[model samples]
Target: MSIPYQLILTFISGGIICVIAQLLIDLTRLTPARILVLYVSVGVLIYAVGAFDPMKDIFGAGVTVPLIGFGANIAKGVREAVEKEGLLGALTGGLTASSAGITAALLCGLFASVLFKTKSKRM
Candidate 1:
């Protein structure tokens, strides 16, 4: 398709995920942490089943920037690790694969915290 169509698809795909997350937050008792875990778990499942590959081709970062994408990375890491390192790979692969991302996130958070002050929420 064209660039415009791809952009539309990407926006819609990401928007749909956001909408679902918001609805769950508004209409259910589940906490944000649980919802995030659900998204990541679903991502891993979809990745494991090979469903996310085609979607990634179409949605690009729209599909890959979310927690689900993180989960897919974890699954991919474990798979490759298992193939190369035997059973121990199952235990260490996810952490090793995601370590950079986790470190980046921590560094970013630290930088932001240093650059800004937290304000108390006023009810």
Candidate 2:
């Protein structure tokens, strides 16, 4: 497939996920963190059940491009940990695999917080 097509597919998939998340937030009272965890869990479960492989094969990172991809990384990390460190891998793999993304997000948030000014309330 062309790179453009691949990107389009990935964007659509990611957008759909975002829309679903928004709907859940608007319709219910779930916290953003809970919704995020739910998406990751669903992705892992789908991958575990042998369902997400074909999509992954077709889209490559496109299928794994969203928070779903993060979950997949965790699953992969756990599997690797099991292979290398046995029990320790299970705990470390997920965090290790997703660390880069987490770091980037944190760095961005920190930068925004530093650069942006807020109005102070007068007593």
Best by lDDT: 1
What is the alpha-carbon lDDT of model 1 when measured against the actual structure? Answer: 0.90
Best model per TM-score: 1
Candidate 1 residue-wise lDDT, 1-123, digit = tens: 899998898899988888899899999977999999999899889889998888899998788888888998888898889999999999988989889999999999999999999899999
Candidate 2 residue pairs in clash (backbone atoms < 3 Å): none
RMSD of each: 1.8, 3.8
Candidates in order have lDDT scores of 0.90, 0.82
Model 2 lDDT per residue over 6-108, tens place:
8887777767778888999989978999998898998877766776778786667766877787887778777788899989887888889888999999999
Q: Determine which window of 10 residues in candidate 2 has minimal summed lDDT.
A: 57-66
Steric clash count of candidate 1: 0
- After superposition on all CA atoms, how large is the RMSD of candidate 1? 1.8
